[model samples]
Target: MTLAGTLRPQYDCVVVGAGVLGLFTAHHLAQRLDPRRILVLDRGYLSAGASGRNGGGVRQQWEATATIRLAREAVAVYRRFPREFGYNPWFRQGGYLFLAFSEEEAGRLRKVSGVVRSEGLPVRWLEPHAIQRRVPALSTEGLVGATYLSSDGVIFPFPVLWGLYQDLRRRGVEVRTRTEVLGLSREGPQWSVGTSRGTVRTARVLNAAGGWSRDLSALAGLAVPNTPTRHEILATEPVKPFLDPMVVTLRRGLYLSQSMRGEIIGGFSLEHPGEGTSTMPSSSLFLREMSAQMARLFPPLASLRVLRSWAGFYDETPDGFPILGEDPRAPGFFHGNGFGGHGFMLAPAAAPRLASLLLGERTDLDDRLFGPGRFLGTKAARPVEGLTLG
Candidate 1:
């Protein structure tokens, strides 16, 4: 690794975006190559995007086999973080409980239970009474059944970001914040990345721009099938610990869990899709609908004061899976932007695999399902179902 000597005309690799995915990828790149040759650029503060604002629920309750595999590996990486990186991310293994209010949802959970169990993950189908047994405070009056994955839980996203950022800085990785990529062009075999700050030349460039990924792809003269939608979350004032596991209701498109400080932090899906960049207050409709649903789910928290609320956009792909791996036409370029809503949970594990691919090392994991070319006539190997909105 060498020192940053002004803005060089060439670099081994240039990673766009300094979010969790970008920093982790840059860290892995630094590990495999000279850190001096790697430059990480972001348009905003570290983890300022969805990576930081999202409710950090880490679980393997995915419908698709591929997503389940990725999540399985990701949660393992998150669990081992304290020992592996000497940073306690505060991962709570309180588990995740998916409550199904309607019979249709319950049936779906039954099928998903088979899928996860087939993968050797400890997901079991539970009756409403069983759901009550796990989290007594939950209102299961209308619920038919639920799915419980005892190993699933939550972690603090900022701590994880700090840990990874420290590693990148120690490895001499140059991270430029508030530096947005203005444009990108392919000059023969190398890529030229023009940024709001300055121009960067690198042999390879990775797009991990989160919500702005599509625009970045267009800037690079490529078409990426992705959309950014706004998701909102609100935290209530601290109260005595009541619920134990993270509760999710697919039929209602709501998820809730208690933070370490005993504040109930959660959110629900909105029908209106959000577009463009705007961190405005959560809509009145969200406040009304989400609050109503939260009250129904946990009647005990009906009196909890709403502390505050904010919204962030998620880079959702066509099939609800991320577009990973190198682009065929855009040579020496890669996509790690679309994790839908699962980017943070998938970061710790996805980084090492992406690094191996960039370093030309062998990997057993098949990232082809997440390739950009999949939208270009390639049939996706897996499909998404079940209640997943993290």
Candidate 2:
């Protein structure tokens, strides 16, 4: 829905997408510049995209140092969000457990756990007995060991998005939902953005449109190597809260967590034909596979009924990391997409860091790590294969 403010012909900055990234980016921009000069445009209602469709998982466990740091900072912000914004995101520090069933998987976890520990995070290597003790419902057959991060947790995403949206509105930032960006072009020093509603001219534009980011970048004559893949998730009927921590099977790329409302919320990736973006009717394949995996892992959940299932797109990059920073060809355009499956978790820190970069402020995160320039190189084309554990 459009706000009461008059639509300006031009703005200092126009942020595309009203998801968590866009909302947080606009909020941070308001803090750095005049709030009235910033405008946020979304194709659909706020939180209608992947931001609201995720499984509400957050974790600081990552093999990359840059991602680990960003996640740590993001979790800290999530912990304080409820008190600071007067909105309960239902933040739960139930921890994240990554199970390794094979020697190869165990080795990978060991190596990554080293990096996690080096970053000063509390990560533990749990034996099968310890793993079984922690989650008695899980089957330990062929399970080598697991990595547990006590501080990693989950938070309800919609409240966080709503909180930011309300805060930005109160700070004078104009947020317009159902405003789709049709085209983007550089006109002298400013950008002329053609939208479904109307054309807007802005000195800078932040492309935070998630899965639609590749198309948005193409509109500016920039070809990004990001692909949108459908990821499916489901929730079961509310049962007694038995699962405290989110569990991930590293081998199968499966994960599940019992929410505060007692519904088991989770998803997993199966070998698809690498299909392009299509978030539609949930697949029976995903439901069957996920159910089988869940039942095998946690036998007690075998009889539980699934309430509903839905699909969302993952803006995946070759390196399994997000592409951030400004477009080299388009001077005023910036990127905040290709987050693979961890965009929601990284939003808290990534948005502010992106805003800092946009406003020319010093940031702790080095832009080179997430820069789009990496994709042009031979070494960066190699995929880091692993399921995002959160």
Candidate 3:
């Protein structure tokens, strides 16, 4: 609702960061708890995080089973979002086409495809000629093979955020923007949270602070190894719809998709000169690298003019998996961060699971998989997810 300036004396749960994950988790929590007892605090206005800066690509072709399951669930939710949330996010299921440059990448896709098929999804392996015919403009010179899944798609992110925010407000959840969390301390079974506005007491607190999540954890005497990497993206001038599926190049992490409005939106990664910092500003190095890669893949893109460009942080971890579940050290505290660049896509599905964990309800996404304690202890060499793209 309004950017609430004052803080309530007490709350059942306080969710930090009003980004996509925070809003979605609060939405789920409101469904079970007294809506007024939950509060979402953010340091900036809505659409200020990676949720707004992303290319809006959603896919299920991931290396890990947990990640693929979460993405599959998100696609299903988006398919029914209009009926569930009364908002049309333009969930276009045009499909996602991933191009492989080497046999190593091709074999990885082949293996990951089996995991996806085991999850009951029809992921197809396509030859270079087939991929060329599917997208006539793409020049598949070094393309060894590709993967196609028609069910995986993209959505306009703003509608998802607005719809969730409005629906949460309708259910009486208090959302306070421009309210930054300053300090966190445990007072024996209760939490005393200090904020820029005022102090509030809440037994339960969920850190979905995104790129700043690790910093927030340290406030509560926890040292998380999450690092921030600045990534950039660009949008090309509108052209007649010529592409269908979102095209992805595994080599450079280059991905391009046409928006419903006809703009070619995409993102890519270059050598990071200064990563692990939270400052976000579009860089010339990124623009030069992205333009060259886009032109090399699809020569037609060479003529397209750049409309805009921007940057955001991907809160990455050593192993490329999101840190979820509650912290054992802090009894009532929980974490929903370390999602890297794909947080927006995973928000809808992961939020409900995180809410379940916060309420001590059993969920399929258990602590063993995504718990904040995953990186700790002698058994920390867990399975690593390798399909992390910027």
Candidate 4:
């Protein structure tokens, strides 16, 4: 499984970044194109980026129509991963409960629930008492109401990445790790991708670099509006299985869910101190904020010892949605970054659509919503607020 052999000088398509999105795109491309013609390159090892550092939460509940549809389809793909790829990601369907502590927040949740239900998703309005019934550990003192979607849940990310990587290798797709894409230049119809290892001439290049996608796009002389920000998460020591559904507090931007190993794993959005892409170090500020919020919601968790803390970058966009489709400035360049925090959940559905576009096939999902041209004033940008879920 080593890429020690002499590298091919050319490829039909060179996918940058071997994260879930890039791997899945390569997987789907193998179905239509020759596997040998497709290549995946990453700056680090597989799943070493945001793809491996996430909480693995998957949900269909979204504020935007396109995002909701994408999530629903992704959940289906996640459920079939074990059988399709021979790797179980431990996809749990315990559901997601968004808690609201104020009337304004509850109203927004109700509106979103209505929209989600109208779109044929199984969502229900939960009063404070009903929410308390589902999780007796939660404090309902100031909770106004909540929205529950039973189908939304979580999955183990490592197994998914491993499954995709193994399957891609089995299909003869070249996946080279630690191969940083240094520069991209267009010579006629081919794209010259300069890497740390060597130069690869590719017909098309897909920017799936996650947090570093914007920087990768810049190498091609393309300016994308995506910003990479650091997000932190921590886990507690394994305890008894008590929390069933992933709980999200909309007010404080806190979300938590118990893993299969019985550890409470989650994170919260804080007033980030640093600007732009800086050091991704976990702050005591996050720990203090998370602890206070968790204790307020669930008092017993205060006693549980925090195992460890880590931070990862989130490729955020102004619209808080992903940037997809081929770049207008760079002919053979495609953008698939700016997923914010939901890239892992949306990758399954997004990858196929992106591949379809690359292969010139009619895709079911609307590609325009995520196209990079929107920020260029070619299309209107419909920003999805209150959907990042941190």
Candidate 5:
């Protein structure tokens, strides 16, 4: 909380990464502690990572009870984001329509529907005709069935970052972009975080670095079970508004939605795993596959010229869930990574709880549901979250 230096010699809590998850956690941390005591450091500028390059689909249908619960809260948070964060992310609750092209995927959706319904959210099992009724532009060629939750939504991802960044700055939370963490050494009860700027001491540290999380953990002399996979998305030139809900095909692992600006922004799953380096590269293979799938799904968009394309990394876990909370291997170091491609949606609900944990408060999810230690030994073979599009 010192005002004398450009980079302070000490902080009460130092958050690694300035992405949505990092900023959101710092925002909550500022609420309970002196904002001056919190420091947010990122190697790149805001929205330079996955936070900037995602199709903002927010849905509550998840395979795990914890994920569904978190997603349910995320929808509510986004609904009131403008009032809460002083910026409008243009969140639209037009619902999320998940289609199943095969009976295998159909069965998966049925199970997910049951799990979602059990969590106090209503989901409708729709036949192909019903799916067509929702978005008539969609072609039901290999469609089996689908599930729909009218409350599910999508948002503008950039403003969510700007809103949180603006709010954090206003609250005196120092978010230092282009300041990368070089090393993490245990200094008795505190952490000596060596950054590109300077070394700072902190009683607690949260690794919310997303894609670079595994590398960050290694800096602290700990091994984390998370992988970085590059996924690409494309935005077509604006057209007249047609699509209402975010449409996703389970068998194809592709999702698409119309932005408020009328550009159809969409992305699909690809397999490009990384080894702790920061590189986001777009691919012609992605364009070929996603474009072909998008046009085939909606015959009307067959001739729609693509305006631009980009890539981002999903910090994946073997089980498709995020690893949160402190690690046993390192005493004071904590983790907030491995949310994969869905962190933007889940961060709203998760950040506050993680901040509370950082401030030495016991929260409900500070346990095994998202714990960093959950992947130890026999627990490593956890159940995978099936509703994942990527």
Candidate 6:
């Protein structure tokens, strides 16, 4: 497993997580500097956090214009990720179907359809019959309509991580596993990171530590307004390939996507926000909620035997959107966490823009809305409504 020399206690940049955001930040930095100057430190195996554990749902149907843009751009990168990283990420372009149970929900989705079409995405509004035809097993009892995105799809999370990790290593970026970051300090123009393995110095640091990002910001004397809420997802026994597009019900906060292996994998939102980062055994309440919601939308899954379930934290923000860009208090320390539930779909697009900003390049995308200053005293200059993804 030794791909390069041991850490030398110093580097040009040190990223403190190997999750999607951290890996992409380090990879983007390596694109800007010598590979030897970049280092990625992770506390667990690559993709072991929310990155690998997430439901791998990628879609462009968002209420916020910025969220839409981020997701649209990320989809492009994800389409080309396999060739760029030399491994197919199993990114299936099966599209996404968003079902509505009420006229209000249907009307809101109709508006979102206009936004999606205006943004040049391949989305269309479908009546209940169309949804029933596309997904024969779904129950259309109370359903009114749906927003269908032909370009939306799901990817297996592990191969994407493998491709990113191997690609970074091949470029001479040092990634250390099982290396927990204990502390950090600023020294003149550089930052010193104290870890369980040893200390390392870097000119800049990116805090892409997924669920632990808020804690890392505190170490730099920055109060980040974020909380890690736990979400659980379960799989059903392998079945025939009946479901194609991912089925989502925004009203119920329910989403279900079938894996390549035919296991229907998904979950529903909790009534209250989750507590800490414990990914303990799945509870009966979770199964009950998921089963009830699934039956209400897709009646076919009601009898599907549950295979297994797992949990991961949703690093949530006040607005249920991500907080991206450089830290206002600590310029050299950057942040790219708090995607709420869509970090994986936004990382590819966000990473390159962040890299361009760090290197003083001009980007057409303005990221001030996502800066750390927004949470301090500045309110969101623009109002974002509809489908906040809980």
Model 6, 164: alpha-carbon shift in Å?
A: 0.5
Candidate 4 residues lying further than 4 Å off, grouped into runs, are 1-3, 273-278, 378-385
- Global lDDT scores for all candidate models: 0.81, 0.85, 0.88, 0.88, 0.87, 0.81
TM-score for each model: 0.94, 0.96, 0.97, 0.97, 0.96, 0.94
Q: Per-residue lDDT for 360 in model 5?
A: 75
**RMSD of each candidate relative to the true structure:** 2.4, 1.8, 1.3, 1.5, 2.0, 2.0
Cα deviation of 89, candidate 2, in Å: 0.5
Clashing residue pairs in all predictions, respectively, total 0, 0, 0, 0, 0, 0
The alpha-carbon deviation from the true structure for residue 334 of candidate 2, after best TM-score superposition, in angstroms, is 0.3
lDDT of 3 by residue, 1-390 (tens): 566457789999999998899999999999899999999998888888888788888999898989998999899888998888999999998889988899999998899899989989999999989988889999989899898999988889998888989998899999988888999999998999999989999989999999889899999999998887788899999999989899988887888899998999998876576665557888888888889898998898898899999988888888888888889888998999999878978888999999999898888875666878877887655788788873
Model 3 ranges with Cα > 4 A deviation: 273-278
* Candidate 1: tens digits of C-alpha lDDT, residues 194-301: 877668788788888898888888998888788887888999899998777888888646888999898888988885544566453578888778788888888988
Specify the poorest-scoring 10-residue window by lDDT in model 1. 1-10
Q: In candidate 4, where is summed lDDT lowest over 10 consecutive residues?
A: 377-386
Candidate 2 TM-score, true structure as reference:
0.96
Clashes of 2: 0
Worst 10 residues of 3 by lDDT: 270-279
Which regions of candidate 2 deviate over 4 angstroms?
A: 1-6, 377-390
* Pairs clashing within candidate 1: none
TM-score of model 3 vs. true structure: 0.97
Candidate 1 regions exceeding 4 Å error are 1-6, 278-280, 378-382, 385-387
- The count of backbone overlaps in candidate 3 is 0
